[model samples]
Target: MTKQGAGQAGVGQRWTAPQRWTLAAAVLGSGMAFIDGTVVNVALSALQRDFGADVGSAQWVINGYTLMLAALILTGGALGDLYGRRRVFGLGVLIFAAASGLCGLAPTLGTLIAARVLQGIGGALLIPGSLAMIDAVFGDALRGRAVGLWSAATSVVTVLGPVLGGVLIDLGSWRWVFLINLPLALLVLWCLRGVPETRAAGEGARRPDLPGAVLATAGLGALTYGLIQAGERGLGGSSLLIAGLGVAGLAAFVLWEARAPHPMLPLGLFRSAGFAGTNALTFLLYGALGAALFFLPLNLIGVQGYSGTAAGTALLPMSLLLAGLSGVFGSLADRTGPRPLLTVGPILAGVGLAWLGFLGVGRPYLTGVLPGVLVLGLGMAITVAPLTSAVLGSVSADYAGTASGVNNAVSRAAGLLAVALFTLLMLGSFRGSLSAQLAGTSLPLTARAQMLGQSGRLAQVPVPDGLSDAQAAEGRQAVRLAFADGFRQVCLWCGMLAALGGLVGFLSLRGAGRGRQGGGAGENLHEPRGEEIRAGQAAPGRR
Candidate 1:
């Protein structure tokens, strides 16, 4: 069947009891992955306390999963295309469940990090395969609505992650956060049996692009490691070397993609202005989003003295706003073109971040933080759906799975880099400010030295009692001032990133052009010949 016809037919299928159950399972699995992405931040301190590790060491819990997810998401999509989507989806559920169990049982920080990496691999497989399955099964009329529903549903779960994690940690222990995934996974697996398998187009001859995969993985991995190390080691010596090599390797991967007969990422897609703009915007916008998400919780708990649940609760308003508005934005994009929304969204987000930058210590949450979070949430809602539509709409049906995979990978990579870079900036500013403050203090030289030595843990350090009340009060004020300064600097950087993204998006978008109505650019691209298909197609196997 033609791609359009297939979509229409798929949607036309009655929502039978079995089909409904299957769809529910897919949504839960996909939502769990996205939710877990942001949920663990609130528990970082708890993890550190339980495991007797420093913040830097504890970060591996997040980095391990993010790195694996960012590196392998595109490959996951390709694997889904090679294997039966249903089969891969099932395997992903199994893998995710098993990994979650391992994480819950982990006795040390190292074991937890390892399990997180494995969980991420399963997540990489599940997200794209589930989406592709929805596309292959749903009809055209329902496709947009289904995608919107799926997006909305997952977003709700993402927003809830913090609250759920907080409750689990408060009521029980941090381990419950990981354990919660088990029952959800089991339910999904049970529902999976009813989803029909879609046959792979090139089942017999398809093989992975191993060289391209290796280069891309190594490039991102090295770059992230370098950024993380920069906070403590500075950008000299080994850091610079690793960073440079990463850039070079990434450049080589791009070059290789252009010439590879069956490239891992088809370079031709960049010919579409909409596609390029959307992907670039995705990278920048998401990078900013990730940075803000990572830092905001730290600021709330470390500087503001909020509990884990309270910090997570602070995020609820923004998350709720986003969940409500994203579907509206998607429908709007369908009716009007994506250009205006794309341009406006990032600009508003930039303004929000810039506003937050001005907030100092002792500022009330309602007066300072709420407005910024609200505005940023609205902007995110406006941008995300349209961006997804643009990328998927720019490619052909056969390559839909690939395009989705690439966009997802880029988004995750943006998040990974954002976390590393922003953490470095925040920590660097905090250290510099604290050091300067300590140097000029008139208190005993020993006290000043102690403060400087413990600067990284200033939030946790008790006010020293050797001095008068005035002196102790001054010391506390100094620490808060340093943290405020660092937080403001990071927010300013986020603002700059968002504004730059806006400009790039405005310039690159094609407006309401010939292909904007939505069958996509696939029909215009040349189809593979019989012999070419036999050689280039991916084989059917578990992702």
Candidate 2:
């Protein structure tokens, strides 16, 4: 293959065929990962039903992939820099396709989760390289525009993911969500030919921090397991022990990063208060956003009696609002700094979530759901661009890429933890509500016991057979109300977390400036990939 180094292309003023192909390759490759992140959420209800999985098991389907991706994405970026971006990207697509196929075919819940973990590993590699390739292929003058186009295209794909996944599940089966990725992966692989093989200059001596990556994966996995178990079974000694060990492992990772020669996360970045503060804010706000998105589909389909397609369509307005408003906020953040926007955005999002917590059964979508979704979307749109700018602006120009990548990782980590932790609240609320709702019914003591015991399954708890029609109808209503209450608890928690994120931004981002652009240290700071932000993920920040 004829390789091209960064800044070697002469077509700075116009889009050449190679540039067009490179952009196409990056968009398709990264878009595959983005689609999986969202589409799976829409399919969760069906997946759980098919496998007869509990809430914790269903959570694993999401956490398994997220755990690998969030933990190793930085290392994935490092691998590309050390090797060749195009090679690693191609390999990632292959791995993702293979994993997706396995996911579609897996017969057991455990097997499906295992396949998802592999998919996450593949995602870590391809996600970062998508933007890195554009940075390498396009000249300074065209890189921003190329990134803009890439972001716009990917955002549209992400916005449509839920709707498409809904249609697939409605028309066929949940397996189609994973199977669909196979064809997209094949397309990306074919497009890779147009993307030139590129690596950093004088990069042969550098190595990825494998030890740090391993520790991170272990620590997060343990913590997540402990949290999910605690949610289902309570804070038992075993769960507490596991959680303690997880904390210890994370402490060790920090210690290792502080001294390692080639650290995966440089500790020096935190020396800037803006960097620390903005990241804290990112963690809280994005965590809330992620949790809400994860559970809303379940609430719609399971509790509110929405069809998969209708439930998926329910979320479209919020995503569209996010996609539409990001640019306006990005430009605004440039002129006025990010502090005000960041603070207000999260608070508004918080309000939206709190409002949603009040939603009950039998309400129409337009009156009941759309209002909260709109507020949440507007707040996220306000926050996304400034959050990226805030992270980039907090560090010195030399650390721009690292800062952004760290923020991205933090947002993902936030989501990972939020889901597990809030599951505790949701389960607790569901059990209590189910008990109260069932107390008023004429069901037998045995039926009541069975329903209470299966509360962890939330709305999927099957009503016992051989009951009178009225009794069965009462059982169904009780299940719906109980599930709704649990969802309400989660939304309220998300609202508080988002509000806290705003407070962090206000206190921590007092004088943070906008990210600088052009030559020298700013060379690698391209526009943060909009698709990633709109998809509720952060852009990969690496040089």
Candidate 3:
């Protein structure tokens, strides 16, 4: 077949049986990855209780997957272009399901974290190929519509994930959350038989940037460890030593990417002011979002006296707005350009967070948090679609796949780092508040030491062993007050992050005209389909 014919062959054709099956498989696989991303957050308190875990370990459970996903996802995209997209996508599913099974069976905190790391690795591979597989099978005319359907379908899973996880926790146990993936994985594999195998035309024996992947992972892992440790051991602890090494590793990775022939990430894209600023804004905003999502459940279930399901459903307003309004906002950005939405969205988000920070202890959800949730939801809805447009617009059409991968990776990294760093803020504030609150009370020394040891529990610290019934009641009140104070401070810090994100976009992305903008490929949060990734596949291969 001629090149032009190959390009046009599937365009406007009836969706063949295989094509339908292929799209279904890819959508389900990506949904699995997406659902896992949000579902795990709601299950965190349950994990802590089951594992008898400390705060740092709990953070690691989340970060382990995120760190691998952020660091290695680009490699996954590159691999799809080189190896067959269908083959790699299937491998990723197998790995992810197996990892999920391992997670269900994990007997200890260490084991659970290890399983999650493996799961992250699988996600990195499958998430990129999930879209890329559809790109390979569909013709150019149909690819965009196919991807839109895929995105919409996946977004529904994001909304359902937390609620489903909550039901699993309440109905059975947290282990079921991991175990549930097995059937989904099986269905994906069954659908795979209809998928066409395709790879980008490339040079003979092209190699992946394995070293770059290693360096990035090492750096992020080390730095995250240090941040979590900093909360426990202070800056003087040995965790700082590891963190310093992480800094060095990252610095070295940057230098390597600049020179490598098969660079996993092309650094030159940062030269575009809009590109750099969009990404910077992504980092800041996602960091704040991650902190809020990670901790809100802890506050609701553990401190605010909500049920697991209640805590899970609390963010319905935000998630639903994001799903329902994203396309509308995307069209608006298309008409108005990204500057206004980008600038206004973060500010709204910041204001909402500040309102949440001021919530008094044990207030009702409807009055205390719902309005702030709505405002934050509106902010995210307005920003996300425009943000995607800005990122794609910032780069040349040629780099859409690479740019999208990097942006997605950055958002995940932001969340990973936020959870680590914010955990520190929570600890510092909690300890200080506890110290002051207990100073005037006659709590026994053992009681104080016990509270200190449970620092990782945040608002959920268990009752101390030796207190009298009357003293226990008093101690409970003191712990709750201290935790509440700390939570307020954490919320305030999130507000600062969102505000700073807004500032970054305002200064860097705004151009000469009001709400006017140039254009590029329309890259959304999901991996771009078609030639954006395929375009680069022809290189590194001998004719």
Candidate 4:
């Protein structure tokens, strides 16, 4: 067949049974990567206990994966472009499956963390390749719908991850959580056989920018580690110094990208005003989302005395709401444009977080947590699809995969940074409050020192001998008050971040109805079907 005929045939082939199966396989494979991100949080305590690691140390299992995924995602996109999306994606699946097995078999905390890092690399590769494959196969009109379906599938997995993890942890073992990925990976591999390859426009010209990749990975990893350690050690310590080095490395990367003959990330992409703005909004909004995901379960189980299942189940309503509404917002973006939803979504999220901030100790779940969650979910549903559309539309088609990868990386980084910063702030505030209370009491200096030393676990701390019943009761109340204040403070910060993101969205994002036609040659390449437009097609307002 002639090239023209072949091209037409390929487009038509997308609707066939084989193509549908291929798409389904790709979506499921990619969804598992996203699901694992949220799933492990539910098993955090169990992992820590089993491995006999401190809370801070155990957190690295999650942090390591996310940090690597965020750092390497763009590189993964570049790899797909250089090689073939199908090849890279399949290899990623194999690696992920292997890593999951290793994780399940890990007998030491260090080994587990190492396995998680490997899993992240695989995840990074899988995500961009999967999306790129969709872009390669689907036509413009169907791309959005395909993306919506893919997003919905991943969203469901994300929402269910905690509940699933909770069940496994409570009834089975934490290892089951990691072990579960093995079977899923095998299923994806089997399904992948039906998927065909679609080469990009300039496939041969694409090469991995190794220097840029190295700099970005080192910088991001160092920065994340520093931020995580900042909570335990003061910001001015060695950790901060390392973080500064990481920043320097990232700056160097930016410089290299600017000068490189074939840059991994084209420096010129930021010339698009709408693209830059949308990315900025992504960073902050995702940060807030990450913070909420990280903290909410802890607060529910730790403070509210809810069971693991109850805490996970509590998130179900919010997850369902988000799943139902994201597609609606995607369609609305196709119609009325993304500006209104983008502006309104973040504001609503801010309001919800602010309300949550005011929750006192022992507050009712219905009045405090559930309402906030509901509002947050609605806000997320409204904004996420539009945000994605804006980013993809702003760029040219040739760079769509890279742009998506970058935005995904930024959002993940934001979450990582937010988790680190907020945990520090919350823990610091709680400790300070406890210290102040101890100082105010009639207790002797020795007693005060002892109390302050055990402030970290005040709620569960053993009552000391020779203390009157009144004193014990007073100490308990003070500890409770301190924890309540800390929780409120953290929520307040979340509100501020959400509000700021909303403002950015309002100011920076142009309506899809009012953007430039095409910025560059690379911009208008192959438009993916349904929600999967080329990066250039993601221009602010041009649906």
TM-score of each: 0.86, 0.95, 0.92, 0.85
Across residues 69-93, which tens digit of lDDT does each residue of candidate 2 receive? 8899888888998889899889899
List where candidate 2 sits over 4 angstroms from the true fold.
1-12, 203-205, 515-530, 533-543
TM-score of 1: 0.86
Quick one: RMSD of model 3? 5.8
RMSD for each of the candidates? 6.7, 3.9, 5.8, 5.4
- Per-residue lDDT, model 3, residue 48, is 90
Compare candidates 3 and 4 on lDDT and give the better one: 3
- Candidate 3 lowest-lDDT run of ten: 534-543
lDDT of each: 0.70, 0.83, 0.78, 0.70
Model 1: how far is 465 from its true place, Å?
9.3
Q: Which wins on TM-score, candidate 1 or candidate 3?
A: 3
User: Residue 239 of candidate 1: its Cα lDDT?
Assistant: 81
Query: What are the clash counts of all predictions, listed in order?
Result: 6, 0, 6, 28
Better of 1 and 4 by TM-score: 1
Model 3 residue runs over 4 Å out of place are 1-13, 203-206, 440-442, 512-543
lDDT of 3 by residue, 1-543 (tens): 774565476464688777798789988998887777777777888999887787778877788888888899889877877888888899999999999999999999899999999998998899888877787777665677788788777777767777888999999998998999999999999999988888877562256799999999998888889889898889765988988988898999999999999788789989888889988988888788778667777777777777777877887787787777877987988888888888988888887777777666788888988988888878877887788778777776667767777887788778788888888988899888877777656788788778767867776677787678887877776777787787788888888898889899889876723232344443333474211101100000000
